[model samples]
Target: MGTKGQLVTDPRAAALASKAWPYEEARKLLKRYPEGKPARNGQPAPIIFETGYGPSGLPHIGTFNEVLRTTMVRHAFQAMSDAPTRLIEFSDDMDGLRKVPDNVPNQAMLTEHLGKPLSRIPDPFGKFESFAAHNNAMLRDFLDRFGFDYEFISSASQYEAGVFDDALKGVLRHYDAIMGVMLPTLRKERAATYSPILPISPKTGIVLQVPVEVVDADLGTIRFTDSDGEVLTQSVLGGQAKLQWKVDWAMRWVALGVDYEMYGKDLIDSGVQSGKIARVLGGRPPEALIYEMFLDENGEKISKSKGNGLTLEQWLDYGTQESLAFFAYREPKKAKQLHIGVIPRAVDEYFQFRGNYAAQPLEQKLGNPAHHIHNGAVPAANPPVTFGLLLNLVGVLGAGATPAQVRGYLANYVDGEITPELDALIDHALAYNRDFVAPTLVRRKPQGVEVAALERLDRELAPLPAETSAVDLQNIVYAIGNDGGFENLRDWFGALYETLLGSSQGPRMGSFIALYGIDNSRKLIAEALAR
Candidate 1:
């Protein structure tokens, strides 16, 4: 692969990168699924994966990220094999409502349907099957726009279509062990926080606890008691439908043929319980990839019920799909502050990889990692635009303005003539708009300039070509950074502000100029100076 300078020259690290760890993880999971079994045909069955788009709120980026991570690996496999790999994105719509999600039209629906199943809600979109359909539609739209390939399997569809009939019967046969394990799972108190889970009948409202024996296999009948001995009712209550999480985890690996699965760090319990279920029920747990949590702009883990998640729709306004893809590929290893701010870096790295990919020749492996992250290859880059202008352009464009409209508004102050180099930039913008909603806010107005430096800037820059080199521009900007009676580094900081951002402090000025077009950079800073 190619790099900004020379190839990395290290064979071992290159080898390590060639088979991305995530892909390996997926392969390991295959061994645990029925598809992993040796066969004459040697063709693997489809892998069924699950995700819950809770109605507690609009599905956010974290929601999409979880699903996308699975899709990413799925793509890796598809790329490598002539064979088919099926992935199913499941919705937990048949479950009951624990709380109301933000932005949903009906708040009263929660109490009105208090004990009713989530699958029974009326469709808000008026076209979908039910309330769950509207919420799922938003998620589906995002997944499709972002290019995720997955089969949509809803709880309503699974039950109504009777996909769980056999599994349900198996669950009844193991009902005793299910109750034996779940009842004590609660009351870990003082040390562990357990929210007492119990299954109840929706029609009877009878708490189905103790010997969760054959509840009505049909006509909706079943109940389970929580730690508080309160009965909870659910229409779809059975081993398969209401399989105590651990057993359910194992069963899916067997039933749907999921080979690989990844979960957040906080879900250790689910992972542990699923491991147990695998041994007892399906006889094997899916391959596990534990991911780290995603923090907000303020470094807080995003929570849907808590109204803290920033949806994928919002992040798209400031970033591209490739940027988002790269972000997912890189993160989930450690917790880092997240916000619209992370987009630029992801975009830059993606472009760097693309540049390298274009210049280098390498073998394509279906199960191999993207490897570009380690190959020192430069990714395709979206030509640089002024950050301020980008923010503004996206600001208006993000508000559902068409690309043509965005182009018209951008033409007003983007004084320089358009260049073919920026075609990539336009494409990135289009993808961002087509994928996500506008962010609630942009990065703190990219980190403020000095009047003395500003005054010198106009003259300093006047001699340059309308389209100048970023480095050349930055060099000129810093050459005079020590102006205006300055004696120390602090004094020169103003120059960085003037040339790079029209502020006294900002990103590394040279790096900033290199990424942002010189002309647009000048225009933005000049306007800021005029203020």
Candidate 2:
């Protein structure tokens, strides 16, 4: 039988609980461990927060996601408590180079380097000292640009310096126990020769996956035969050996005193295995928040191997960095499709979050994504025109329009002077339309049943008053499509978009037409009919 029910009420926690679920979750954790570590002078230790990346390929959007999301929760945690926090952005550069990415240059040069540690591989781009350094530099540049407060740790350097020597020894000492935890998850065949450690061959310096012949825990040594059939014996310390990934993950948590970490849903099984290993090694596992992976437009999980998602550069080229951060802000557990198609919506939502933050109550305001997106310093309000609207303006104003021409149209539409910030947004919108939209544009004639729908749409637009509201115009467009035998509103809308913008999709037609003016709209319709 259960104990007596208790109705608990804490105003502060309740307030956070009402706004963002993440903050609510953080608040509960803090409340549960009010007297956690390092209470030297009656003050609790700073929360040790960590996120890690495997530098196998160039750091992609997926890499940035963990940092972005972890930082968001860290921000929320700061609001909920006076306890200090530290976010460690660890890079596992010691990982063996499994395969050279197809996108990287000089693939022929990499055949000799396969199975070598990432830090030891030559930078194919010749821009950085090593492949790992290049990717790490790219990651640091991005973090610096975003002003993320974090400490970057390279596993290669840490290993070489013996920072994890003790933990590596512990893994070797408890070899059988670690195997008991890991082998059950592997195929029955793989369990036979698998070892917890992969040693760098003394001859070739490549990480060798050969079967470990012996592990002497008291001696702190492991013996394995290299591919050359040379019997090599190396001390498990001083970077001579590295534990397998899951064991390394667990050991890192124990060694670094990690209190919180976030992982992609794909790592759930690994997290469970690692948690068990951490517990077996007499260390507490860090709390975790697992998020679903991002997918490409095709609904396949976005992967470096698949080359199915936008690179950080592509996203920044098409939209603001804050917009990308906003994309990560919503529903962390829900799978999202990240493609160029989503950029416009993310930008518009960023603006909306910015506008709403000012008027929101204090409790709700702190939880607003814009609060974190701007790092608590939200910019001035933006013009009502959205990225989608600016894009429509680009198409309506015609391709090859200069920045000044776009600004002039935007000024007229929003009825305000375009600020420098807004002007920059316009620049990006035009570039996006040119790169992603313009090339996809087509001027196909309406065929059969669709032809009458276009004629009916033109007839309806001709009679509308110049002062008609966008709402009324939208309703009229809807009515015209239903009457012309194209009952599917989307079909009619597609025809109108292709006719006017040379694409199958554009901004809300009513607002677009209203802003473009009756004269301009009629001229475009006539041009479409002639085509």
Candidate 3:
């Protein structure tokens, strides 16, 4: 637990900060999964990094975090050496549609198509070919906007193309071994009759979970009792069958020659199971990076099902993609609380890191987060104004203000002319204010004690020189709050935020008021007090 500016330099932090870390790790993985290894089975081998998507719901910020973080590592790997690398974004759309998502349309229709493969189910939105196709397209659209260069492979297409046929045969041949690994994890009843290969019902084309009568691995087929109690045999190839989730994960690593992959902390046990299955199938498992989950402000796990986590769209509305990327850039294994309120601070921190990255030596630069955020091609500098400051300006200016209007206001606050970057920030700030701030504005008049406190604050500010630093004004605000009978600074800050920004929290009052100007601050506070 280290705070900013605190010298809590540990050996682990030092090692991660070292320039040689990425290069050494890349070279090590190259050696571990060498080009001419037996695992490739005479196929051309590329250093593969895989990420899986479950298209049960719309892709959220968490999904973006996984892809962006993995891409950062991939970019680092490329910076290390010229060994060809590929990022495979896999979609598990062939899995059965056990339950319909509550967010989508046409719920009654989805209920009728339950138990079918997600790819086979009709799209609830009625715009795409299938439900899986719609979600996969959404995933592609977002990733493409980010300029990500990667291969997208869907499980439905892979199964139809017989890409996993060899893996399936291997699983069937060693069914007993896989069950030995999986059975212990299941309850007694489930362990009694669990099959690694779940064959789709030949009659209805629905994925079946019935008992397997026989595994004729020699013929590359399985006889399974379907939902209707009719026994049937299907070739475990070309979309006839799909391995269980854990088994599919392990098999994908071997079949695709994936050298590296990462997963959430909740999948730690599942990763172990997959690793065991991979080793059992005579393939070296991919190196793993298990990241802790992102929680909401309330400390509950962020999930698409729970709809508690902030979506990627919401963050982008308030901040840049780079800021969101920076949030995922550091200490991935540590639990991070992400919400709409933290956007401006994250944007500011990114600018701070960008400054550090630009000034640091090449050796020292590799350890900085901006290095990874920009994929080692960091910009020379950031905009002059902090996002929080710009946001505060937006709060006061009202969301309806035009970019030209903002440019006019900023011309006086900042020393130099408003550059193109500042112009862009103004646009983002106005959008952020409209989406997150303006609608929450408090418009009631302050009475009695609140009125007196505002007047006192306004009187104190009325005589201050325009050149007064933000720090000095901050002290004055604190004293006014204490003199106004607030228990502590936190409560006073809360009151100020509620009366001023119409939010429970906001940017530092001193910097905000200072940038807003002395006379303007007094007038604004007076307006609120007398509303």
Candidate 4:
């Protein structure tokens, strides 16, 4: 078991723990390969694969998630390892473009490039080589911005050149047996109307199977040729692809030289196949780490190209990148809800992970300078403020708040980057939108003080110290509480809440006074009472 943000010590804990993250997922991976069995000399390399989707449109959050999961697992191995390792993000741009996303305003521009591999799609914006190239390039940029290391291999390039020839042959060699298992299982489990491998035409909704034969299967690949014996395409050779997805998967574990891989429970039958294939094909299958599917909070899988999908880029533009990272990761074999509304809790969790742990392998990977700065290795010389503050600042500045806007309104003199803090606060404020009927949700009331408590606060402010600071303000709140009236002097609670929250139940009143400056504190209270 592990604490929140702690390295998981057991696999079952992956499914049981609250606030699950990368650690539990890592522990689950470890369980697949016991501590000392088949004791090899050193750590085996993990064969990590992100089934890169055809990126004909802007990539959605889930695609990023596929790679992100791989990245997280990669880090776990790195964190657990004594040396460096690598992971790859393979894109199936060779696959035909599926559909146009709503976010992209120009639908017509994408129509001409439908049947070809996404990489060959012409860039509508005329910025990249092709449509697939344009979308994937942006997505890759987005991923790289977050510090993911991926060696990208385009299926367009691979297939056209017959890179998987041997693997395709293997698939042909075992095609009948492979279909024997998959066809029945899929029919019984899912009401799937289509085969796992489609033979449909892109232009029309019709199935067509011309014909192809295995030309070769060697050098870790499978090659395909037309019935006329003209080389057509190639994949990793061997009945490898035919080994039932599970068996094929097991074969992947061996052929790809993968040490760890995770999938959804929806693929359980395939997982069963991977195990069978591992035994049939010799050696061990890669770790079978399963994660739950993510549905919108309302309960539907987030779909790409439907405009209904939540994207990582969209999430990051609004919330911090780290916030997106923490939320994207999870463990278990069920469905989890991920939507914009959960941003705050996710942000809060990320911060807590940073403040409470040594960051590396806990909060983030070590040696990332930006992550260090973000976590506050650079001491905060000024008083702390929330992200809500910065967001507000952005709004204000847009409406013409300047550095000098500092003294114009809400004017009090405490140091720090006021504008930035204001922006953070405003951004933080929008998080409550989850509870709203519209896109924008504002915090209702400032965190409340009682009339008597207000008076007490007033009286405390009378005898001002030469050096009023947060501590001094706190003392005043405490003093008022210590000497009070009636049934328990609600002044204490008010002071507590009002002090930190500005209405009380927050920081010490004295400290609040000091941190926010006496003027701002007094002004805020007065305005609150007036309202």
**Across residues 1-531, which tens digit of lDDT does each residue of candidate 3 receive?**
234655434534433335443443454565674543343456555788889998877777777888887787777766645567899999999999999888889999999988889999999999999999999999898789888888999999999898888888888888889888999999988876677888888778788776564457766788878888877877888898887889999999888888888899999989999999999998888876788898899999886668788888878877888888888876787898988877888888989989888666555676788887876788886786788778877888886878877776666567787877667677778988888788887755665577778888988898889878789999898888888976677877777777776777677788887777888888789778767
RMSD of 4: 7.8
lDDT of 2 by residue, 166-249 (tens): 877778777878888999999977777677788898788788766675557766788888879878788878777777889889
Task: Name the lDDT of candidate 3.
Answer: 0.80
lDDT of 2: 0.80
Which segments of model 2 are wrong by more than 4 Å?
A: 1-15, 40-44, 213-219, 414-416, 439-514, 517-519, 525-531
Model 4 per-residue lDDT tens digits across residues 1-531:
256656854423332342334445555555654552232367554435444455655566766667676665555444443334456565556555556655664678766555445665667778878776776787678668766777776555554465544444444455545555555655554523322232323234222223333333344333333334455353433211222234434544555555556666677766776665554444466564677778887888766535565666557655766666666653335577777667756665555555544434422333222223242242233224434332232232233334344333224434544556444434443433222212231222333335556666766676776356656666666666566543464645554343324321233345435534555556655655554
TM-score winner: 2
Cα RMSD of all models vs. native, in order, equals: 7.5, 4.9, 5.3, 7.8
What lDDT score belongs to each candidate, Candidate 1 first?
0.55, 0.80, 0.80, 0.50
* Full candidate order by TM-score, most accurate first: 2, 3, 1, 4
Q: Model 1, 137-233: lDDT tens per residue?
A: 8778877876666788776576557676565555555555554555466664521322112354444432232333355645444455544655644
> Which segments of model 3 are wrong by more than 4 Å?
1-44, 213-215, 398-404, 415-420, 434-514, 525-531
From the highest lDDT down, the ranking of the candidates is 3, 2, 1, 4
RMSD of 1: 7.5
